[model samples]
Target: MDGLFLLSSYAVKDAILIRPFSLADIQSVMEIQSACYPANLLEEAEHLIAKHQQSPLSCWVATEHQKAIAYLLTHPWSGDTPPALNTPLPPKKPKSDIYFIHDLAVLPSARGLGLAKRLFDTAIDWAKQEKLQKIRLIAIAGAADFWIKQGLSPVNDKTLSHKLDDYGSDTHYLEAAI
Candidate 1:
């Protein structure tokens, strides 16, 4: 559960395997990204790959029938402000007790099956295993409620608001203690 390759089987309508993401899963991840996010929010392959390369243990995919249906992208970070969208995380992030959840997406067809929560649990499990202090993420558009359900409260910080313009309006920065 702590490592990237640890797989969890969910007994949903269709059997889903929550497993580590690989470079080969990029296209399927993109399809899910397109289905879940707007053009401006969809991440490029290089950015996704960069995050995986930098922190493979923090990234994972939910696969059904050997195809990616959902994914969670996370990486260690040292700040309150999240990184820029559509860009690879810069090397040498400051040392801190937190990690940034860059993105989480599930295919429309896979909704209502609890795939989102399952993927989220994987990331949370990792955080707990690592003794991480916090989990930070941006709740884009209509995602605030879902994140709230996961125990993250909206963070009212000026640095985050000014830096998140590329993430569009209605984005809320949220964080929760692990």
Candidate 2:
């Protein structure tokens, strides 16, 4: 974990190493995923790794005391639709205008540490640097309100809505300008 990026003043008023995710963080990421999501919603580690390999610049893990407590997985995407649950990102995808927030999770024990927002700020910073138009994500379960507080408005496209059937009964598509 040497050379990990440290974000000392993310306004959480505590030290947290928000570092680019290395392959070594996969197991920890999976553990956090399992703790945060239901079995049917958990993504395979391979799919998560492919995303990291594809966009290392935007993928990040947050550690406190050298233990990963949260992570943000993101990548460039067309923004036409959210990927289905457990699906691997397709190869040779077309050019992208949106930066997709594939996953953001913090362990229950780590909640209220402002870790999720710090991790999200990491992704937003990347999207701004890339000059992507907007940030997009499917807020599964009942997490839409948390995202709403982040300034992403709910998307209302019927075509896009139909495609998210596999995401779950409570999934919601949301987006925000960069």
Candidate 3:
């Protein structure tokens, strides 16, 4: 968090905007993901593109001065199982009561600018707008605390423990009411 611009004077707080992702923004999206996550955990481009292509309205990018600095990917899911990372979503949106957050990555330099909160708010607002019941995600990269602070709680269901295992040993399935 060293390079994070915490003060509003940086204007990153006021100037940041969130919009739908475009194919042209892929590289910047990938760069931000690379900076935020390890190589093995970073989502593949195919999966990212497919998610957006499937539910363009559910995927979004946060920008500063019109440059992509962060992104959030989400899709509908029917059951408790979260989709495997790096796997492409189906071409059509799934029928479901849950909105699964597939990814939320902000560059280290942009961490304190409130981009993550903005992207998170966007997801919550979208779910409400679409009449989805709740939001879900697999917490990784030691992000369980962050999600918990955002109002998501860890799933304690015995049945979900195995499906969540695919994410990693520390992976946590979290959900929040809409």
RMSD after CA superposition, every candidate: 4.6, 3.9, 6.4
lDDT of 2 by residue, 1-178 (tens): 3334334344245557798999999999999999999888888999999998888899999998778999999999884767776877877366788899999999999999899899998889889988999888999889899999999998888888777877789989999999
lDDT comparing candidate 2 with the true structure: 0.87
The stretch of ten residues in a row with the least summed lDDT in candidate 1 is 4-13
Q: Write the per-residue lDDT of candidate 3 for residues 1-178, one digit (tens) a residue.
A: 5446465455664678788888888889899989988777877888788887777888899988888999998887777667777876655545689888888998998888888888999888889999999888999868898899899997778887777665677788999988
Q: List the residue pairs that clash in candidate 1.
A: none
Candidate 3 local lDDT, residue 169: 78
For candidate 2, what is the total of clashing residue pairs? 0
Report backbone clashes per prediction.
0, 0, 0
Name every residue pair that clashes in candidate 2: none
Sorted on TM-score, best first, the list reads: 1, 2, 3
Superposed model 1: Cα runs more than 4 Å off: 1-14
The superposed Cα distance between candidate 3 and the true structure at residue 166, in angstroms, equals: 4.2
TM-score of 2: 0.89
lDDT of 2 at 175: 94
